[model samples]
Target chain A: MSTLAFLGEFGEAIQFIFEGETTREGTQVGGSQFLELTVEHIKVSVVAMVVACALAIPLGLWLGHIRRGSFLAISLSNVGRAVPSLALIAFFVAYLGVGFTNVTLALVLLAIPPILTNAYVGVTQVHRETVDAARGMGMTEARIALRVELPLALPLIFGGIKTSAVNVIATATIAPLAGVTTLGDAIINVSGYGDVGRLAAAISVAALAVMTELTLGAAQRAVTPRGIRLESGRPSRRRTLSTRIGRTASP
Target chain B: MVASAVAALTAPLAQVQLRDRSGGDAGCVADDGLCPGWIADNFDRYVDPLVQHVYLVLASVAIGFAISFALALVAHRHRWMIAPIVQVTGILYTLPSIAVFFLLLPLTGRGSLTAIVALVAYSLLIIFRNITTGLDNVPEEARDAGRGMGLTDRQLLWRVELPLALPEIMAGLRIATTTTVGLATLAFFAGAGGLGGQIFADINFKSNVVVAGGLAVLLAAVLDAAILLAQRAITPWTRARAA
Candidate 1:
């Protein structure tokens, strides 16, 4: 339970990597360690998150900027929300077999909706007058969207990204079933070994998560455009009330 | 045609039920007859576990909502404090389920208590942020008018701001409910029970019917419906708006 003991397990793995004693499958001087499991999991999560960000960002921008197909994008994102990511991951495993590729695909699918929805909402929510002013100043539509609208929406978009990153990082623990190694490997493998290792790895992942949260949050705030507030400091009761009414009318 | 189609569809189902075990290979005992009974027994095994699963999610979400709502109210009054708290909660919200569960295991052990604590921590950020945002969105003029009319702080919150914020708060609850249901699946990994157990069983046994897959889908539907109903009941305003 001491920090030293906690670091002992994690640090040993690091030392193994540094000492070149660790094999791809995780056998070491002691033979047949769980390092490979750890590597596979880390790889699965990283690859999946990278892929998701790649696809989702562009789609989100389009949906956020274009405003026409925004509903389609938002709805797809909503459906993503509705269907549990774990179920989707399981389904992929069922259909595609347990492996890195399928697991990554599932995580990518899971990560997209938040990113896409947030980006789209962020851009769309950029004030109409701001867009008009930009246009009046003779900025091109693309230029306006990129320079003006994007900056305005950056905070919200980053907020979305922050949210997605947390989700992906946490859900990555489940990637083990798809034959991808992850932090969950320890939790699952060491369940019989007194759960100490499991607890240790869990703490490590949580630490990693807290670190990830702080880092991304700083990054989000950094990228988030400042000095833009809605003319109304708070969304008026009448406005929200009206929007609620409108939403109800359609549904 | 219908009979033949049904048989054809069931052929795959039968095959899945008969597959070899992947992880829990030791337990994949095959029975050529009584497939229905096999499925029934599989479900029966889960009765106790499934109850635990439902209990874990409901309890954690309820606790999380209460804590988050209280915090949100405090933040609402002290507007300057909202950002930091929201940011901090947002970070907590992002912690991986396994990570959070594992992190808490030292103190909580591998029990429902650990899972609930972790889940409640995760839920707090979302629920708190949403409630604060909802309450904040209540008109300042309305609040000022309430105060001008000699309404106390509590009176303003309950009679004015809370009602106005109900819709958004309910939306937050819906989001929290769905997220809790999904995350609760991880509880099985920790031995807390529920649809995850069924799904895990199916996964290990390679039986599609009993594999955590089918049962999870069913449980998800039920959870979704239950939350939707709860949302409707708590925010009768939502119904009023709809009507």
Candidate 2:
């Protein structure tokens, strides 16, 4: 096809995405509009991340504070890296039937390991001297964990959440496989929208992922304590997080 | 109660006996109705796709490693380039695999080429980050010593820097390889032909899903192990020091 023809098809698909349409045969499908699909994609990704954070953060914090179960945390992260997200979704869909809940659950499983590992690493990496000083000042274990460790660990915790957020958003593109309508609906159901639709959906998904990464990265930077911000001569937390994630995959 | 709930949910899906439209077998079973005998009978069908999947992974990782290594080297020398290069690759990495596959389809057409492009893009961030970090982590003392010994920059990099960086680089390669193996499964959506096509062909079939998915997992494990062994072989000092 000519480049102009391709662009015309792409423009038409974008129009279809904006202005909801009905088929010539009069079937009413309400899910493919760009705004609606974006909302669905965000909803699924946010819900999955929320669920992952709810489970992983507290557990990761407590485990890190206690400084035990390093083996478990490390192993879970490794296993998470090893398993394919598509396989997880397929397994859930096969057993649970297709729905938002099944996809969210699969994505939650996908998001957890990173958050957990990061939080664990974040807390554990807090200075030993700092913790000891807090203890010497008569702080309880819980108090020290909350007052001393949590604040210091916020950057890495946010890093983990940011990682999971980006991952969940990217993986959420497969939501259509589980009958949940997301941006992927355009690409997966090619008969419904054609090449234009696939390209547009791909564009939308990539934009969404980049947007999520930037937004969360800003949030991560914002949440870093002023003391740590002043310690910026150290390697930035973002690079550390990526390297940690990379290393954890192999170890 | 959970078991019954699962049974209730799955019962309806079982009735949908999706025919294999790809002309492999008309007698494919539904969800939960995996016929082991049928899987054994049709084992050969998976071999071609598995081989394709391996080729897809190897080609992508090889290309990705080369590009990432060069980029890492450039960024290492010119520190100003690292952030922009990382940002660009990070965005590429964050893009969904399915989206990338289809997006490239228009420009590259459907085949191994599109699949490799997408897979290579996905591998870059992991490999690039590791390579740069590995290079950066080379001890300043070691570099000074190499310079003191009158080693040329090229010789120093080849002999001292790259060797020391092997463990990290190998870690990156292992992650890239295993992750590529997983992502390659989705390349079937772009008509690239891999285990994903087989799994998608009979998504509800337990035998098909298990066999295809298992092979993908097995391939990941084997490749990971092979990389680990290669790392040990290349960095013999690491093991010797441990001993």
Index of the highest-DockQ prediction:
2
Candidate 1: TM-score of chain A is: 0.74
Q: Runs in model 2 with CA error above 4 Å? A: A1-10, A20-22, A27-32, A234-250, B1-31
Clash-forming residue pairs, model 2: none
Using Cα atoms with residue i matched to residue i, what is each candidate's TM-score against the true structure?
0.77, 0.90
Which residue runs does candidate 1 get wrong by more than 4 Å?
A1-40, A136-140, A191-194, A226-251, B1-47, B78-84, B204-211, B214-225, B233-243
Clashing pairs in 1: A40-A181, A41-A181, A41-A182, A170-B96, B198-B212, B199-B212, B202-B211
Candidate 1, residues B1-243: lDDT per residue as tens digits?
334324422332121123432222233344222144345445455566567767987899899998988787877778667668866776677678867766654345456787898789878876776676677678899999999999999999899889888767776766676677777777765546666655544553335433455555456567767766776777777677778
How many backbone collisions does model 1 have?
7
Winning candidate number (lDDT) = 2
What lDDT would each prediction earn against the true structure? 0.64, 0.80
